[model samples]
Target: MELKTLSEIDIISASTSKINQVDFENLTFGNVFTDHMLVCDFENGAWQKPVIKPYEPFMIDPSAKVFHYGQAIFEGMKAYKDTHDDVWLFRPDENFHRFNKSASRMAMPEVPEDVFMGGLHKLLEIEKNWVKKGKGNTLYIRPFMIATGHGVIAAPSSEYRFMIILSPARAYYSGEVKVIIAEHFSRAANGGIGAAKAAGNYSAQFYPTKLANEKGFQQIIWTDDATHTKLEEAGTMNVFFRINDTLFTAPTSERILDGVTRKSVIELAKRENINVEVRSVLVDELIAAAKDGSLKEIFGAGTAAVINPIVGFSYKDTYYELPKIENSMALEIKEKLTNIQYKLAEDTFGWTVKI
Candidate 1:
């Protein structure tokens, strides 16, 4: 295997090529790709030379281990362009840490932080035009790894492929998502890969989430696997509940995802004097609170949609609705967070990293 340092990557001068023309304004999430991509391979106990190539597909063996044994993991993050056209990434180091965590869970070799960050910079610099300048427009960065060894045996593969793809995307509009409080299905279990963004974890959710969608709901608020009593998280985001004025969210465990946005919100909420509870929230207690008119709001914190407020939810055939308030904690924290993301406000927490 050949190893190349970050300094060795050549800055290639290429024109802004267009392909499969689509309307940028009306684009749905993760539907459009930029002109360039970054790729690297791992073999013989080392990561090989990295390359930046045009956005296209390549050949892979039909009997690849990743196809048969499902050895894959991925992460979701975004890149923002400010009014001055400066590119920035929100808490990229956090994403780097989490990506390694996911790799460890999937039995994949951990990627070097220098390689990951350096490759990202080179890719972003090449496709800088894909990052539109506006509040809602940004580049969605998908970094993923797969077992590429051509075999079907049930064992860890000897070869792997690491690639980074960029999509010119508009803000995801998950307007007032209606959710079902989980009672029958579980997203993750104790000592499972639920804490990490493993590829299998997402595939396991499609069947259950599709059922919820058929029942006129947008997503499912997953509960604990052992007992199914405590709220864990949502399909793709960490959940937060508000009773009266206090904010309650489940603490991260071996079964819960340690979301960067979730942790940032907790810190910001505590600094703002919002009573935050990092404990297991039970369905019965929340239902009782809603009955007594104390449940004020509920939302999900994630990188895609900074904060997605839940308008209502159903549990065991009972429905609960949240009243909209003038001063919503969800909106306030989202504004403060996005401001730092777009470099429009002071990053007192030192969360923004420029590329």
Candidate 2:
């Protein structure tokens, strides 16, 4: 596929604006969307000219391969508005590279950088007003591709549709989170599509998460599938465990998704002279730490929540509550990262990109 220029994209302005109808002060995460969206079709072994048009549903065949074989992938990102009214993206290139990596894992075509990043730039420029200026206020970016080839056969699709949509979002979670450790359910196995951002990977977790939710837990800390002994992820995000001041998180493998926020957190912690170890924390080890006074904190990192501190965790019907502390490393790191995202503090790592 040949790379194309941004000027080739077709633009169609919306007939009317819905900005006035929305109440920015109060928003449900991922419920509302901007007026315009970016779309590009893939066929004949090549990506077509991209289009930026009004946000609305488009028809698809009932037997599309995505409905059968699940040839789909997506990426989560955000656009933030600074005090100067400039829109910015945090580690967008990382998302772009990971998006293609997921595409390859799912047997889908890779989208060109121009179609992905350029289209995003053009789309956000039109919807700049949708990005609210303040900490915790952002325009959630959802870029996804799905199999569009019409067939019920169990195979990869010949056609695909790539799209980018924007949604105004506040905080993802409000209350303290309690998690249950997985014993039977497995999120991914060896040589599975667990590391990819494929749609099925998320769908596979719904049933187990629903079960956990029924038991009065907000999420589940998934363990390794083979033995269900090593802590891998919390809900849909990468998890970290702070044992007596040293941060420990499982290294990314075939079973764990390499989260951008997770990497950022590790780097930021190191920069702040905090000890961070990239190694798997065994379930037994964690239980021992919890029994003693070593286990101080457990948190999840991802693009959505940034950092979600776990109040406690349940393992083998035993609940272990984390002690309340005045100056928490999780809160401190979250504040520093969010400040960088909102441009309130100096971005010493050169992670933020202006648009």
Candidate 3:
């Protein structure tokens, strides 16, 4: 499909702004949207011109493939506003490349750069006011595609809709998190779409996560599907374990997400002369490390939470509590990442994209 130029995009401005109604301090994550959004339709063997319009709902036939067979993919990233009110996006190119990688896996058409990145810049330009300026405050950006064909016969749809929406969000996870090791439920299997940010990949874990919540755990640390012995990741974030000052995280594959925050933390650790191991982290090693008093920290990294520190984890029938150590690596990494995102510190890695 041929890409459309920026001049070809259609714009429909909102009649009124809702900025006055929003409480910048007390925002429900992802519940409040900006005044506008971006949408592009794919049909007739090509993608049409992208459109930026007021935030409003549009109808789709019940037979849409996304509703029936779940032909959908999405990416999560954030936009930050500095004290000087300059807007920034962290490594959006990674999200753009990953979005198309997910589309190819799902048999969906790739959204062109002009449509994805171009529309993103245009939409943010229109709603730049929604980006809050402060630590732990940013505009949550969701870019997703859905199967919109009228006929859903248990197959991929011929038509698709790619859209981007901006939501206001504050810091997520106010307190320390507790998790359970998944010895039974699996998030994704071998040769599957686990690595892709498909909607189903997340929805599939809802029930298991609910069960863990029932057991008083906030989330689940999913393991390998076949063995359930090697720890893969935590809910929504890539999992990391610090044992005796060495950071260990599972290598990304078909079953694990290649998280942007996870990679950045690894690079940061290397810069600080800390050891990082990118390999399969076995549950047994973690348990043994806990017994030997070497398991110092566990944390989750992603675009949403930035860095979520896990205080405890359960395995088999026993739970282990991580020690409350001073000068935590998790907090340091979070500060570094958020500082760069907010333009407070030098963006040494050149990860920030200014809007």
**What lDDT score is found at residue 234 in candidate 2?**
76
Give candidate 2 misplaced runs (Cα > 4 Å).
1-5
Off by over 4 Å in 1: 1-5, 10-16
TM-score of each: 0.96, 0.98, 0.98
Q: Residue 8 in candidate 1 has what lDDT?
A: 52
lDDT of 1 by residue, 231-312 (tens): 8899688999999899999999988999999999999999889999999999889899889988889999988877989899
Candidate 3, position 303, lDDT: 89
The models' CA-based lDDT, in order, is 0.86, 0.93, 0.91
- Model 2, residue 26: distance off in Å is 1.9
> Compared with the true structure, what per-residue lDDT tens digits does model 2 show for residues 242-270?
99999999999989999999999999999
Q: After aligning candidate 1 to the native by TM-score, how far in Å is the CA of 315 from where it should be? A: 0.6
Model 3: per-residue lDDT, tens digit, 195-227? 899999999999999999898898899999899
Model 3 TM-score relative to the real fold: 0.98
User: Clashes in candidate 3: how many?
Assistant: 0
